[model samples]
Target: MKNRKHIVICEDAKTRITINRKWCKGCEICVEFCPQKTLLMEGDKAVVRDIASCNRCMLCELRCPDFAIEVSEGTGR
Candidate 1:
């Protein structure tokens, strides 16, 4: 009899984030709030520079006072 190891892994799939420049104030709130440092300041706006490492924390989108950032769930971006 062979013993099988049970592995329970939470699917930490990377998701894509979209930024709406119109709503962005270039305050870099999301860039600062992201746990993964997924957002970066480009010129006067924030951009999703590290989409692969995004943990879907939603911190960026939620913390944005101007509602500039949007994120997609469950799919690999």
Candidate 2:
């Protein structure tokens, strides 16, 4: 008989998610507010293509005046 031991570091998967394209006004406020620099301007709107880089800070969601963004946790994608 043998016992195997393994160690792993688990990180929180909760992340900032969802972007209401129609609501977005292309103000770029969210782009500037992201401390992690997770947002980018795509065409006339801000696009959050890099979901993995997001730390769920909610800066984008909070800064959006048009209610264009929504940052939340869990697997609601």
Candidate 3:
């Protein structure tokens, strides 16, 4: 998952989560901390499982030790 990033925009485009695989070490912290269960571990990286289920709480981003996850407003750019 080196130098890889995945972005997902919710239905309303009000929330966007950016996962920076370069910074992520596959610790699974984000997956465990997400209140919405919006993330899942896929091998050595975290992938968005259900974008609509995400509540934009930013829990995953906040819990990521490597600062690899970010939740932003608007659509993914």
Candidate 4:
């Protein structure tokens, strides 16, 4: 079985973050680059530690060298 991916959506419906565990290599770049400190490394993967502080900046997605994370902006409804 494949590892489960993680998805997080901001309450204001402005930001969505998708974490593909299968592709992630636990590089910590996403966790380190997040300006809002929304992501953290747990064991060997990235997890959403705080969604409220997320600013939808997309830095995590952009900095992910393994393409394990994606950041999207929309109404979320």
Cα lDDT tens digits for candidate 1, 1-77: 14322211122255657677666788988888888987789888887676778888888878888876777664541
Candidate that beats the other on TM-score, 1 or 3, i.e. the better one: 3
Model 2 whole-model lDDT (C-alpha atoms): 0.70
Residue by residue across 1-47, what tens digits does model 4's lDDT show? 34343433334367677777778899899998888999998899898
Find the candidate with the highest lDDT and give its number: 4
Clashes per candidate (backbone, < 3 Å)? 0, 0, 0, 0
TM-score, model 4 to reference? 0.78
Model 1 bad stretches (over 4 Å) = 1-13, 74-77
Candidate 4's C-alpha runs over 4 A off are: 1-12, 74-77
Alpha-carbon TM-score of each model against the true structure: 0.74, 0.74, 0.78, 0.78
Q: Candidate 1: minimum summed lDDT over ten consecutive residues — where?
A: 3-12
Clashing pairs in 2: none
Cα lDDT, all candidates: 0.70, 0.70, 0.76, 0.78
lDDT of 4: 0.78
Count of clashes in candidate 2: 0
Task: Candidate 1: give the clashing pairs.
Answer: none
Question: What lDDT, from 0 to 1, does candidate 1 have?
Answer: 0.70
lDDT, candidate 3, equals: 0.76
